[model samples]
Target: MHKGNFKEMYLNTEQLDLGKFKVATSETLYMTVVSMLFVIIIGLILGLLLYNLGKSKRIGAKIFYNLLSIISNICRSVPFIILIILLIPFTKALMGTFLGAKAAIPSLVISAAPFYGRLVEMAFREVDHGVLEAANSMGANKWELVTKVLIPESLPALISGVTVTVITMIGFTAMAGAIGAGGLGGLAYQEGFMRNRPTITLFATICVLVIVFMVQWLGDWAVKKTDKR
Candidate 1:
């Protein structure tokens, strides 16, 4: 539907004016959930590997850790926007196109995984050394140490880190909107700036701020519930 000037856009608060925005919000939520799942899963794996390597005394472990460290640093060092544009071709190859929520996953996962991975490593490291020693005295294997000791011990911090990662990823989704990923950011840009509809833009901004606040409150509550210390 053709929208008139800003005044008409504000006066006409019908579904037609909001249809695309609703779709964009759905797309944004889908992308955030999927991307966050990838981040958590992949980050846990990488973090476990790094933590093990750091705790080991073997030469091969050191060599492998160095390489992994370099890779993780590089991924985190590059700005998100540059990473998205640079990886567009790869994302397209992976998802069949460099637009829409699906296409945004590659860059999101690539960037977010390393970020969360660092947190994971730190969380595990924060586990008490005495508990680790006790586990070792009990003849627990590496798997047992991780499952029964490291993970259980570090869970509170891990939850907090993941919460922070989720909040960060929400912002990333907005940035991804600039590349046709269809989110609040894209809606604000297209409808507000391009079409000069401040009402739509203000509404989009409010939606994002609300989401961030909701996520933060939920995260804090979860963290408090999980934290026994």
Candidate 2:
């Protein structure tokens, strides 16, 4: 392997334009934030449904739980890259294009929501059964049980799970960028790797790492604030 000069690589600015870098960074952040909102909202609802249905003794509820579980599993099992390709038609129909940051939102949400839903379900399951029993004995309704008891008790775990999910979404954005989604990943692939400019690739990678670290810090802070125990 031909290892280029490190100092020259770092100092070179001929190929790395700050303006384009900013645009790519914005695209990455946009995709991640937009998709994360949908993922969290939809995943939370799905998780709650799975939890409630699984707890019921009714045969119909059991059937529905199994059905949802299967679907969620299928979504989670598919790789994100293939999922994006598979959803191209849907993306075009929804976003009017399947080749930019906005178009990547549907694929990101679909791929990440079920994964986050499973995390939410696991977090809910980890809630203390004794607390649930106490709430039940006090004549708590289903809504009260979920909103006041279940979610509150599981808030810390939920935050932690969301933290993980957000990080995963960042990675998904990079993958989406690889195929013309126009983020740092696209910049790296097109302007750096293909054009033999290692500095731009390195720069984009560092930016991604910084974003991930910031996200991890915020998540930990949120979890600590919410955790009562």
Cα lDDT tens digits, model 1, 1-229, are: 4556655766445523667778878887888899999899999999999998998999999999999999999998998889999999899889999988889989999999999999999999998899999989999998899899898888888888888998888888888888788788788777676877767777887888888888889888988887888
Kindly report which residue stretches of model 1 are placed more than 4 angstroms away from their true locations once superposed: 1-16
Clashing pairs in 2: none
Model number with the top TM-score: 2
Per-prediction tally of clashes: 0, 0
The all-Cα superposition gives candidate 1 an RMSD in Å to the true structure of: 3.9
Candidate 2 lands at a TM-score of: 0.94
Candidate 1 collision pairs: none
**TM-score of candidate 1 relative to the true fold:** 0.90
lDDT of 1 at 20: 79
RMSD of candidate 2 to the truth, in angstroms, is 1.6
The reply for model 2, stretches above 4 Å from the true place, is 1-4
When summed lDDT is taken over every stretch of 10 residues in candidate 1, the lowest stretch is 7-16
